[model samples]
Target chain A: MMSFSLIVGFFLLWEILCIALNVSDLILPRPSEIIVTLVTRFPVLWPHILQTLYSTLTGFVLGVIIGVSIGVLIGTSRVAYGVAYPLLVGFSSIPKVAVVPIFVLWFGSGTTPAILTAMVICVFPIVVNIATGLATTEPDLEDVLKTLGASKREILWNVGLPRTMPYFFASLKVAITLSFVGAVLSETVASNRGIGNVMMTASSNFQVSLVFAGLIVLALMGVALYAFFSFLESRVTGWATRGNDIAIT
Target chain B: MSMTSDISAPARPTAALQPATQPASRSNPVHPRPAIELQDASVVFGSGDKVVTALSPTTLRMARGDFLALVGPSGCGKSTILRLASNLIQPSSGIVLLGGREPAAKELRIGMAFQNPTMLPWLTIEKNVMLPLKIVEPFKRTFQQDKKGAYRDRVHALLAQVGLQDFAGHFPWQLSGGMLQRANLCRALIHDPDLLLLDEPFGALDQFTREELWQILQDLYLDRKPTVLLVTHDLREAGFLARRICVMSARPGRIISDKAVTMPQPRDIGVIYTPAFVEMTQGLRELIAQIRK
Candidate 1:
């Protein structure tokens, strides 16, 4: 309740500050004007919103699959970790925006470039988090399973994977937001679709409210997906953060 | 962490006691083999200057249905012995065998509990207790069918015996330390393993809670006679629970003294106060003190 009220107060403050300062729409559009643009342009904007959402989801899913596979390899094997970790670190440090044009050059401007960008941008965090989760598994737990005569595969399935849920979900929230950034970056660089493309066209035409409207849409999508992932994290890993109704043994 | 050791029990009415001898007949053909044997088995962690001898040239054996306790000061490799028997680590030298085969033999089923309750946090106490049934054989083969019928009932019965029947649906975190340890024992016994290895399972509990768990353990042992190898620090605990107690020295640990507990079976918690029991623990403590020097 407090956070909801604080957010409302923040927007109210922004609206008052803009109107009192008499800021030009081109210089800074009011939240009221942006909200009006969002409502008025909903019909024209729907397809672009769908386009960004589709590309981001596709890329995010692909990133997670590849990340988990590499993570298991790196987490379980010393050689793989030593070899891949440096390369991954270097790749992740590079500005993802710089890579978007190269993706466009290869894919020739459209959803493919946006998707490839999102996939590459989001993969690093998932890989790092999953590997950390797998590597930090309790040795005592492993010994318990080993004494049960459980096969390596069985131990990995029963213990290693479940133990990694918290780390996996944490990375998903981070990577989901990054996926949006990547998709939009690629759309702005080359594609003629998505909210990023809409913003670019609006700004060039000096449709400041439409540009602000695009930003609002992106912010809303980011918050919505982040909320979705938080819900998922709670459902899957509720045990990790269960209410302190009883003291731990 | 399979928390719960064999060392803490000092309870049970002597009336229900049975002789530790007279091996119960199992279904196996041919002569029965000792459940575990370590011949000159030694473990050295790391190599070169970093090499620390965890156990030095130790030979130990346990017959089927034997309840043996290994006791010593901290760093005495008592836990290493348990780990060796469980095949969690290979000895740096010599032989370790379970049922006359290598300790890692596929057919061998072992149950283990440590000093820390190692229940998977994601699973409810009931599911955690039933973990072995999903892995070990015969039961593993028909687990889905049996889980709903005989297997589920067995878990409930064990839970009821340990006074945890109502908490079956609860997670491990909902229980206290003592309660989780009871559930730990149920998990260890659920699959009817041939060997049950316990490493200081009660080492973390209060004196009162530890004694209460002793009775639960005593009942479990009398009902199901799996060969047990317990590693613990408390001599009274060692004396109370096992038919035999082996005391080891400090680091580079090796069993220096092996003594048989003469107290009759199903000893009550009062046994810890009896003259004979007190004398026995005193003697074991003195032996350990002498060897430490």
Candidate 2:
């Protein structure tokens, strides 16, 4: 309820400031104007919204799978970590937008470039977080399991993976957001679908309110995905935080 | 249940008694195979100029069901012996065997507990105790079928022995240090391993709590009869729990003295106050003190 009121107050303030300043619609559209445009353009914008959502979701899911796989590889083996870490760091440093054009060059625009961009951009955070989680598994705990004749695979399954949940979930939140950025960035540069493409066209046509509407939609989607991952994190890793209640008391 | 009553000593005295007459020795030719045999085992860490010998060449043996305590000052490699026995680390030199064979070659069931309870925070105490059954063989093959039946009963019985029966559903974080350590003991014993290794398992508890756990551990030992290797600094603890105590010298540690506790078996915490117990502990203390110098 508190967060709901805070959101309302923020929009109300934005609305009041636009009216009081008598700002031109082209310069900065009011929250009311953006909402009006979003509602009026709903029919025309619906396909674009669906396209962006589909691409982003596809990219996000693919990115997570690849990221977690690489993360586990680096986490469990010192040789893999040593060989892959520097290469991953170097790749992650390259501007993802620069890589989108190369993806476009290969995939020839449309949804493929956007999906590939999203997948590549979000993989780094997931890998780093997963490796860290695996590396941090308690040696004493491992030894207890080892002396029971637990094979390496058994130790990983019972202790290593469950212990990695908190770190994995934290990375998901960040990775999900980055996935959206990659998808939208790719769409604006190379595609004729998605919110990014729609916003680009609206801005060019001086349909400022429509562009503002697209921004709001993207923000809402980003928030929704982040909240989804946060829910999962709490469900799977509740043990990590629930212990604090006893400590505080 | 109240903690004291829950962990009260058993009514039967004979359960705790071993023959009391037969002392253990490396040269006990009558025994076909010692449960654990370290033939001149040594451990050295690092290399070149940074070299440090953690354990000097040492020979030791324990017959089946022997409870031996390794005691000395800090860094005397008492823990190294436990690690070697458990096969967590191989000796840098010499042979380390279980039942007269290399540890890896045998399907030896082993259980170990450290000073830190090290419970996985995610699991309830009951599930934490059952971890070994899910991984160790024979148990692992039938674990799914027996999880709700025989395995559950075994876990409950072990928990009841340590006064943690009521806290089986609780997570490790909800329990006190003493309670968690008791659960740790339960986890170690749940697999009914052939070997049990404990490293300062009660050293962190308060004096009263520590004494209470000693009795709890005593009860468990009497019931299971696994070969036990305990590493502790407290001589009284050694005297109360071990059939024999081995004292070692500092740094590149080697066994300087080995003495058997010939007192009557299955002794209670009260035995720590007896003249015989005091004399045995004092003798070990002086041996350690002399070696330290």
| TM-scores vs. true structure, each candidate | 0.93, 0.94
Spell out the clash pairs found in candidate 2: none
Tens digits of per-residue lDDT for model 1, A1-249: 677899889889989999999989998988899899999999999999999999999999999999999998998888999999999999999999889888878879999999999999999999999999999999977777888888989899989999999999999999999999999998998889999999999999999999989998999999999999988898899998889456331
Residues A1-249, candidate 2, lDDT per residue (tens digit)? 678899999999989999999989999999988999999998999999889888888998999999999999999999999999999999999999899989998999999999999999999999999999999999998998888878999999899999999999999999999999999999999999999999999999999999999999999999999999988888899898984555321
lDDT of 2 at A76: 97
Largest DockQ belongs to which candidate? 2
For model 2, the local distance difference test gives: 0.88
lDDT of each: 0.87, 0.88
List model 1 lDDT by residue over B192-288, tens digit each: 9888899999999999888888778877898998889989888878887998788898889998776666677776777787566666777778888
lDDT tens string, model 2, B31-68? 55888988999999899999999999999878888888
Off by over 4 Å in 1: A244-249, B1-31
Give the CAPRI class of candidate 2: high
Interface RMSD (Å) of candidate 2: 0.9
Looking at chain B only, the TM-scores across the models are 0.89, 0.90
Total colliding residue pairs, candidate 2? 0
